[model samples]
Target chain A: MYIHAVSHYFPSEVVGNEHFTRLNGLSSEWITERTGIRERRKAAPDENTNTMALEAVRRLFDQTAIDPSQIDLIVGATYTPYDTIVTLAHVVQHNLGVPDIPVISVSTACSSLINAVEVVEGYFAMNKATLAVVVVSEHNTAYNNETDTVSGHLWGDGAAALLISKERISDEDMTIHTIITGGAATSGKATTGVMLKPLEQGVLMPHGRDVFINACLYMPKVSLQVLEKHNLTIDDVDYLIPHQANLRISLNVINTLKLPETKLLSNIQKLGNTGCAGCAIALSENRALFKKGQNIVLTVFGGGYSFGAMLVEV
Target chain B: MYIHAVSHYFPSEVVGNEHFTRLNGLSSEWITERTGIRERRKAAPDENTNTMALEAVRRLFDQTAIDPSQIDLIVGATYTPYDTIVTLAHVVQHNLGVPDIPVISVSTACSSLINAVEVVEGYFAMNKATLAVVVVSEHNTAYNNETDTVSGHLWGDGAAALLISKERISDEDMTIHTIITGGAATSGKATTGVMLKPLEQGVLMPHGRDVFINACLYMPKVSLQVLEKHNLTIDDVDYLIPHQANLRISLNVINTLKLPETKLLSNIQKLGNTGCAGCAIALSENRALFKKGQNIVLTVFGGGYSFGAMLVEV
Candidate 1:
């Protein structure tokens, strides 16, 4: 499968480090030093996962000549959902006015975006679908308790859209060389690290240290594993977009992979953790800078502990 | 893909019509007349989606020779999840001691089981996985309002499991010939008919009549569509297991298909609406009686209005 187009949406509301300083009693310098998140985007009260997702897809359609009718499959990835049943996928499908097609909403927590792409790949392999649209929206603010001191300030709302094809539709499209996703619940302290309790406590990261340790261990391991499948190495990677959770984690992954600071592309400094939309949003932001034969690796680790890496080349 | 084995689990607690009559102030006769659900299985207060799923998969493993290590993929289907982030799939993987593999939890509402099967089919097509286990569990009681009067009596909790293979592992295995899924959020009254608000209203069916109308229209349509893909019709199907939402809905579907009442297999009169687990539980319950050369059509219509049909041959 190939990535035909990519687009992203972040809310207009800018939340700076000072906001967390007042709410959680943490100093602005401390927050910046710990997370490297100087500021992040927040969705408005009326904006939600579905709305942001719709906006992202509309942006994709506006920028590209691809018509909505041509999309045979729609996959929505989100861990924070406004409505779990009428899911983000269903709402997007309803608003797009697209006729009956498979609109599946999938989750492996924050690794959901990669899983969503895998779903599209599956549809393509079975001859069930050709042109597929993947919309990833995270409405963390809707579910995150802003007053919680633990991990409240870490979340930011965002959405991204990607148009993919079974075959390369244009020379501009990037060939997706591999997608490798796996569960790590058996790994040390995975189940208790990070959590989202939609109806009860909202989002919480009680074991942030364990999560950080596991993420640093997995992201580089999976990235290298996927590269091995294509007989490639870290040296061949032109860019690396790790999950936008913590900047320190990104640096740790790149260091382990022996990639230079310039090769690591991160938006967590400006966008915080956008969940499934994080890496995709970063990909959209940087896709224009890519040259032919340039390789980009997107790696992720999610709460409840799912990890994946996707290798795409222009 | 071929189905190697099937198993299910329903809590021992039986919730009868009298319980609803007392809670919702609805007469038992009226409830039975409308839904044909005299009594339904209910999970205990402590039992949730993941627990029920674990039981279902354990039963499956006990009855089959497949080891946990042999499973390459675990796909869990649930609209009523115990935890949205850690997910039923992750918890199942955690407890089973299964090492890292793709453990995906997917939702397309009550049609989730068929969609999960399609996901496994996709993996098989891509050669990403060979032996797959799909667990569908719905803890509707955890989110349903017993005093709501409208849909309070319509929910029951149960879970089912299926072991599927990329190749025909045994002569008794049923070959999955066709799997078709589509979104119908574009259809009339879809968004409003039935909804699950995990953080707010729980489960609500404010527009039951509209859902009934659409369910009647889509179930037989998708069933016949899947049959036509394989150059077969209603005559070729030996059994029809429609979504176990309401027995009246099942009758209407069979009536539209012109299949004999005896060919219609329904557990709704006993199990209630087990959400995503409904049809698969019905399939597992009746699979022992299926003769060689027989065909079974499992068709479903779900809230948020996703629909699908799968045709399997013995």
Candidate 2:
């Protein structure tokens, strides 16, 4: 499979650390030192997961003209959903005017984008669909608890769209070599570590240490496994776009892999954590920097304690 | 792929239509005439989506002892999720003690089981997983608005588990021939027809007529589409397990397909609409009747306005 185009849309409003500091009594310096998040984008009150996703799809269309009729699959991945009933996939399919294709919305929490892509891979492999759209959108701000001191400032609302094809449609299309995802919920703190109780608490991380430890272990571990499966090594990877969960986690992955910090591509410093959209947004941000024959890997770990890695050859 | 085993679990609480008559003033006779439902299963106050799903999986284990280490994939399909963050997939994975496999939760609303099976198809085609479990679970009662007159009586809490293998494991194994799913959200009444607002008015069918109209049109249409895709005809099908949305919809599909009423395998009269788990639960209910060389088709239409048909040869 190949990526024809990728695009991301972030809400226009920039919420600086001062906002969280004022709301949660956490210092700006403390927030930055802890998470490396200075300011993150927050959706307008009227905007949400679906709107941001639509804009990202519009951007994908603007980037490259795609025949809406030929698109056979649409997969939306998110945990913090706007409307689980209407769903991001249906809304995207409705707005994109794509009819009669399989519109599936999936969530393995923050590792959802990889799972969505894996869903597309299934369709492509079955000859069920040739052109597929994997839309990753997250309205973290919509479920953000501004008063929580632990993870109050760690969320941003954003969406990313990827136009993936069963085969290379153009020379610029990047080939997806391998994608691997697994669950570790059997381990400690998988359920209680990060919770999104829309009715009770918004989004909270009660055991940040457990999450940090598991993410640190699994992200690099899965990255290496995916690399080893393809007989490739970390040295061959040109860029590593880890899930934009925390800058410290990404740094840990870099340190474990023994790569320079420049090899790590991230957007959490400016955009906070956009959930599943995080890695996809970072990929879109770095799309122009990719060169032919360069290898890029997007490795992710989620709140369900799910982890995944996708290898892309640009 | 072939089915290793199929199992279903319904909560002990039987919610008869008289309960709806008491709550929403809809007579029991009226409900049976309108939706072909007399009574439905409701989970106890403590029972939930995950617990029911785990029970169904345990039943699968009880029926057959498969190596837990070989289960490489677990796909959970549900629209009415208890906790979207931890997700049914992760919970089942954690409870099953099946570590390090791909755990994905997918929703295309009530047509989710077919989509979940399709996800497993992808993993199988890619050689990613050989042994997979597609767990269809729904906690619709948790979100059902008992006071809503339209769809108040059309929900039940139940779960079904299907252990599918890439290759047949035994002589009794049923081969999945064709599975086709599509979205119809581009058409009218897609979004607002069947809504599940967790915090607001829970599970409302504001456009029951639109849902009924579309369900009647697409259920048989996709049934024939899947049949034709495999060069089979309606005459080849020994049983039709339509989505248990309503008795009226299933009867319409039988009429459209020119099949006898006896050919229709239904459980809606007793289970109401179990959402995505409905058809699978029905299949499990009638499992013993399936004979060698018999062709069974499970066709479904869901609230997201998604439709699918899966053809299986026993």
Candidate 3:
């Protein structure tokens, strides 16, 4: 499967640590030094997962001439969907005026986009579809706790959309080659550590260091596995688009892989970690950095101890 | 793709309208009349998606005599997950001691299990895996508001697992022949009169009447499409296992198809709507009813406006 175009959308409202300073005695430097996030976009009360997805898909529509109706499948990847039963993908299809096509929602935390891509690839390979659209959106701020400096400063709200098709324009048009994807629990205790308790009314409590260590270790190993499968070395990869979990984790993987800084792509410095939207946001921001025949590696680690890697040739 | 064995896990804690009447002002007859759910199970506070899935998978393992490590892929179907990230499939793998494999969580609401099965078939057809597991779990009660009679009485929690493989055992074994799947949606407009807020959390608000109409019209049509592709007719089908959405909907579909009641397999009267777990649970409950060379039709419709139908020969 080939990625035809990528786009992302962040709400206009930006919230920085300064705003949290008033609610919880914290400083911008303290938040930035630890999480590497200066400011993150916060959706207005009226905006939601569907709205964010719409914004990104609209830009994607503008970038490509492919009509929404031409799309054979729609996959929406998210964790914080507005409803637990009704998927945001259907909402996207409704907004796009293409309701008859199948729309599937996938949740793999930050790795959701990769999971979505994997499903799309499987569908295309089986001749089940010709064109597919994957939209990853997250409103983590809705689940954030202002007093919890660890997770509060590390998350933002955003969405991204990518169109995949079997009709490749060129052999170098960034085809998804292979993926090594799975997850494991390191919490030792089953069910206890993985549970997220609601705080006050809507706050989300997360174990940051646990997630951090898992991402740092699992991502590089999976990326290498994918690379090895294609008989390609790390040196052959032109770019690394690791999930925007954090600058530290991404940097650690890059260093461990011994990849140069020029070969790495990231936007977490400004966009923060958009949960499921992280990888797609990174791809959308770095779409221009890719050229025909260039190879790129995308890796992600998210909740449920989920980590995945995909190798694609541009 | 061939189904090796199927198993289900129903939570021990059964909660009927009698239980609801004691806790919240409600009646069994009222609940039954509105949603056709006589009773539903609620997992203990300690029970979750992963544990429930593990229970079902263990039963499958016991019956099939297959080691967990031998499974090449794990497809988890659910909307309510313990974590927003990381799929519950990995949790099952970790507990079962399975090797690292490509695990994904599919959320197409009620159609999720069938969607996962569709994915499994594609992967098998592509020679990507020889053995795969599809686990569907839903914890709707966790999100249901006791005060909301509409949804509270309609939803249930349970899990089911199906072992699928490319190695067909015998002509007597059930095998998927064809799947016709897709979805449709309406813009969230008051004028559409196709929207209903069923939860105070406002996550999965759906118009029940609209969904019923869509299912009644699309499900049988898709089933016929699958049958036509396979050069079969309704008379050739020995049984119909429709998604356990509602008794009225199922009965209406049966009437429309003009199929005999003896040819239809149903468990909604006891299990209610278990979301993604619906199809697997129905199959497992009625396994003995199927014989070799007998054809069965599985149809589903759920949130995302997603609907699908598949023809399988037992």
Candidate 4:
């Protein structure tokens, strides 16, 4: 499988650190030094996960000039949907006017986007589908409570779309080398303390430090395992696309992996942590600047202690 | 991929048609005649999607004697989850002590179980994993509002687990001939009138008739298409395992496909529509009675208007 096009959409409204500083009674610099997020986009009242996903895919179609009818599979990765009855992928399918084809929603929180890629690779490998589209739309605001000063300031709304095919459509297409061959580990029964329980108003995540510590450890471990599967070393990787959750976690992984500082491609400073869309969004934003034969490694950790890694060749 | 083991778990409490008849002021005979459901299990307030799924997988482990450590992947299919933060698959992974493997939650509403199978087939096709476990746990009661007379009486809670492997575990194992080769079509913009909108109580389905008609039409269409893909006709199909949403819908599909009435194996009379777990539960219950070298067609339609079919050889 290869990626023909990549595009992302952020909501119109841009929020700065001052927004959280006022509510949390902390200085903007203190928040920025702690999280490394400058400004993040928040969705408008009418905009939602489905609509944002649709916008991102529309951009992909516009950039690649690919017919929507040619897309035989649609995979939507989102922990947050407008509702459970109808999935975000279904709404995007309805909006795109794409006929039939399997539209699947795979949720592993932050790892969801990469996991969806693995799911689509199955269809491509089985010859069940030739052209597939994956969209990662996250409304982290839906799960983040305003009063929860810790997690509230970390979430931003965003969506990223990828057009992948069994056959490369253009010379510029990035071929997937090993589509999600690594393993995923969860924190298991220890999930109670660091939790996101459903509340009347969205959900609640009580422990941020526990998530941060586990993420910093697991992200590097999974990425290395994926590299080992292919008999490749860290030196073979030209770029690292760690999940853009926080600058600190990305830096931690970089230090742990002993990769060059310039090898890390990130947009977390501008986008905040977009949940499942983090790595995909960062990849899309930096794909154009990457060389044709560069090797990129994507590592992600999600809430509920889910973590995974996938190595891709550009 | 071959099916090594399949097991299902339903809640302890059994609610008969009399329970609904008394509440709705309708006769038990009328309820049974309208829908082939006589009794359905309702999960205890304590039993959730994750716990039910865990129980089902535990049964599969005991029945097949397969080591949990040998399992390479876990794909959970569910529309109703305990919460969005941690998926049912993640919880099951924790309970089972399954090692570091990819645990994915794929939701296509009621079509989720079959679609998850399709996703697993891809992994098996790519040799990403050898032994994969699929658990379909639906808490239909979570979204059912008791006051909603039209849709309320239709839902039942249940969970089913399937162990699919690239290699056959035993001579009695059912081999997959054509694993989800057909296209899945959604009803598109026609979904507004019939939807499960998020509400304070849970979710609400405003239109059931539209869903009934669509399921009846698409169920047979996708099934026959899959059969056609394998260059086989309905005559080759020894059993028809359609989603157990309603007996009338299943009957309509069997009649339209011109399949033998005796070939239609269903448990809707005892277990109300189990959502994603419906067909899997039915298949597990009837697999022992099936003969070797027999062919079975599984067709499913889900909310979000998603539907698909897969053909398998016993």
Candidate 5:
């Protein structure tokens, strides 16, 4: 499997930390220091998971100018969906007016995009599809509880998409390394405090300590395992694209792995935690900065005790 | 991929048609005649999508006496999940104490299981997973609206599990035909009346007429397309396993395809529509009757305006 292009879309609303700080009786400096999030984008009143995702995919198509008829599959990853009945992928395909294709939605919280990448890789391997698109659209606002400071300020709305194909289309296209592996540890779910429960208001309460600790432990472990399998070390990785859940968690993983701070790539400060789209969006924004041949390690941990890591070359 | 074993489990509560006949103005004979549903299972007070699915997989393991360790991936298909955060796959893996594996939840309405099978097949084709488990556990009782008679009486709660391996383990193992293909048409969502709107009651009000007309058309078309790809026709099919939404819809599809009535295997008379688990549960209950080298076609349509078809061999 190879990545032909990557793109992202965010709503127009740029919400600053002052809103939460004033409402929760905390200073802007405190919020910034705690989460390293100065501002994040919020979906507009009319914007939604489906529309944002559609725009991101349209942007990918615009940049690549790939024929829409050539795309044979659409894999959508989302934890916060606009509607439970009409899938995000179907809405996207219908809106795009693309040909009838296999549109599947896979949910494993924030690790969704990587899992979807592997899924499309399988399709390519089996010759089921030659060209595929993977998109992650999340409306975290639907699950945010305004009064609950822990989770309220942590979520942001956005969408990201990537075009993958079995054949390398151009010299600029990046190939995914053969050392991709992902799995989850269920014991992490037993730590009850960190959970996204469906309340009357659709609020997701998170235990900040438990989530931070578990993410620090698993993200590094999985990243190292994927690297070790390829007979490589953290020093061999040019860039570390960890899930932008929190700057502290990302920093912690870097310190644990003893990687240089410059290698840590993130956009959470401006984007917040976009759930499944976090790391993929970061990659899309940072794609131009990478050389033609550089090793980038993508690691992620999400709600529901899901964690995974994959190494790709750009 | 080859199916090593298949097993299903239903809740203890057997809800007879009389429960709906007395509430509404219809008689038991009218209910059976219209939908061919005499009774359906309802989950107990303590049972959930995860518990029901866990039991189904446990039965598969016990009956086959296969080491649980051999299973490397778990893909759970469901439209009604207990929580959006904790995937049904993660919960099942937690309860079963299965090793750390990729636990993914996919939703394509009632067509979920067949789509999941194709996803796992891709994994096998790429050698990403050796032995994978696909479970369709539906708790339709969670979304049923007693007042909306059209959709309420048409749902039942049950779960089914299948162990699919890249290699055939025994002489009795069933191999999936090499011609498996699946895709969805999105134009159906444009129909106005047939939609599942999110309401305060958490109910999905489906338009009966539109669903009937479309399922009758697309189900047969996709089924024939898949068979034609393999140089086979409906007459060559040994069994036609249509989604157990309603007996009327199934019969309409059979009439359109001109498939023999005897070749149409169904359990909707006893197990209403089980959502994503419908076809899989029917297959599990009827697996013993299947002869070697039998050709089976599974066709399904779900509320999200999604539909697909798969051809398999036994």
Candidate 6:
């Protein structure tokens, strides 16, 4: 499948450690050192999960020139939906004037975007859809504890939309070469311990170290699998877009893989971890850096102990 | 596609109008008159969405002698998932010991079972999976407000599973003939007014009159489209399994279509509306009513203002 276009949206408001210090006793340097994030975008009072997704999808439609009616499927990957009854896909379909097509909502935490991509591949493979749109949006700030220095500074609100088509682009345009994807849980005992907010008393607690350990170990292994599948080493790849869970984890995976600095793409320093939208947002923002036939690897480790990787030739 | 077997699970505990009378000031006669439901089942405190789905899936595996790992795809249709982090399909896969295969969780309200069928059809069309399982489960009791007489007594908790395979048993071994699917919203001023729990006052308040009018008008029309495409008439159908949204709506549709009384299959009087599980559960329970080479029609309408119809030969 070829990615015809990609777009992302981050709200206008920015929250930094100074704002956190006013709410909690944390310094900017301390927060930055712990999570590799200095600031993050926050949704305005009126902005929401649906609004962010619509912004990204609207831009994608404008850029791709694909009519919404031509899109056969709409997949929304998010943990925070505006309404459980209606589904976020319905909101997007209604807003975009494509209400008759089949819509599905997927939630696999941070790896959700790839999961949605896999589903789109299934539709394409089945000849059920010629064109598909995947919208991944998350409001991780809703799950943050303003007083918790670890999570507060490590989260952000944003959305990304990618338009995929079974019609392969010419080699001169762009292409996806191969994908190697799999995930496993750690005995169902190594819990990430992360919880969504509006929790009672001690509900929302996470073992950040355990999560870091899992990401540092599993992601690079998956990335290597994709590289091996394509018979290409990391040295041949031009860019590696890892899920923006944290800046430290990305660097750790890069160093462990022995990849060069110029090969890594990241936006967590400014955008923080946007949950499912992290990798897609990074790719959309850095599209200019990509060249025809350039090899790029995208990997993600998310909640539910899920992780996946894909190799694309751009 | 051939259906090897079908199984369903309804919680053992049944709640009658006597139970509702104590919680709300509703008379048994009034409840039975308003909706065709006389009683409904609620899952035990320990039973959840995953457990209910597992129960139905186990029955399918046991009856078909199919290994969990051999099943290529698992599609779970539900509105009440345990958490937003992991899809209920993953929980089902883990519980069933089929963790490697891809799983998709789809939410199309009460039409989810039919939607899952369409997805499996696509897979078979693409030759991706020789065998697939589609599970529809609902724990509607969790969202019911005892005070809301309109919806509280109309919903039940249950699940159903179908084993669809690419191998053909015979030319008429439960093959999909045609599926006409679409959705339409009422004018901008009109809304379904169906509110999900824990977010919007924890009640299911639907505009009963509008929903009834819409179902009576649209359900038969879609059914006709499916029959017309198959070059058959209503007189040729062996049975009709409409989504168990209400007894009155079903009867109204039957009267308008002028179908024979012996040809309609209904379990709503015994099990109430089980949301996405309604059509599947009804089919599973009433399979004895169908004969080889007989035509059957399944239609559904639900909260997303969505409706679909499919014709099949059993």
lDDT by residue (A161-236, candidate 6, tens digit) is: 9888888743433555565433343324223345441212211436777777777877898898888978999888
Residue-wise C-alpha lDDT for candidate 2, range A1-314, written one tens digit per residue: 99999999999999999998778888899998989899999999888888888899989988886777778999999887777767889988988888899899998999999989998998988888999989999999888888888888899999999999998899999999999999889987998899876556678899999999999999899889888888999999899999998899999999999889989998999999999999999999999999999999999999877999999999
Top-down lDDT ranking = 1, 2, 4, 5, 3, 6
Ranking by DockQ: 1, 2, 5, 4, 3, 6
Q: Candidate 6: where are CA atoms >4 Å away?
A: A18-30, A143-153, A168-174, A177-218, A224-233, B123-128, B168-173, B177-180, B183-193, B228-232
Q: Write the per-residue lDDT of candidate 1 for residues A1-314, one digit (tens) a residue.
A: 89999999999999998998888898878877888888889999889888899899998888678788888899998888777788888887887778779989998999988899998999999998999989999988888888888788899999999999998888899999999999898887777788886657668899999999999999999999989999999999999999999999999999999999999999998999999999999999998899999999999999888999999999
Computed on alpha carbons, the lDDT of every model, listed in order, comes to 0.90, 0.90, 0.76, 0.81, 0.80, 0.75
Clashes of 4: 0
| Candidate 3 accuracy as lDDT | 0.76
* Model 5 TM-score relative to the real fold: 0.93
For residue B35, give model 5's deviation from the true position in Å. 2.6
Error of 3 at A291 (Å): 3.3
Candidate 2: residue B177 lDDT (0-100): 91
Candidate 5 lDDT over A55-106, as tens digits, reads 9998999879788778888888887766555767767667666655777888
**With candidate 1 superimposed using the best TM-score fit, by how many Å does residue B136's alpha carbon deviate from the native?**
0.7
What is candidate 1's lDDT per residue for B36-144, written digit by digit as tens? Answer: 8988888887798889999999998997777888989999988888877888888888888888799899989999999999999999888999999999999888888
* TM-score of chain B taken alone, candidate 6: 0.94
lDDT at A306 for candidate 2? 94
DockQ for every model, please. 0.76, 0.71, 0.47, 0.49, 0.50, 0.34
Error of 3 at A15 (Å): 1.4
Model 5: number of backbone collisions: 0
> For candidate 5, lDDT tens digit of each residue in B226-278?
89888888888989999998899999999899987998888899889888898
lDDT of 3 by residue, A173-285 (tens): 56888877765543332223233322123324356666667778788998998999999999998999898867888888899999998888877878788887887888888
C-alpha TM-score for every candidate:
0.98, 0.98, 0.92, 0.94, 0.93, 0.89
lDDT of 4 by residue, A79-165 (tens): 877656577788777777776777888888787877888888888888878998899998777667766666678789999999999
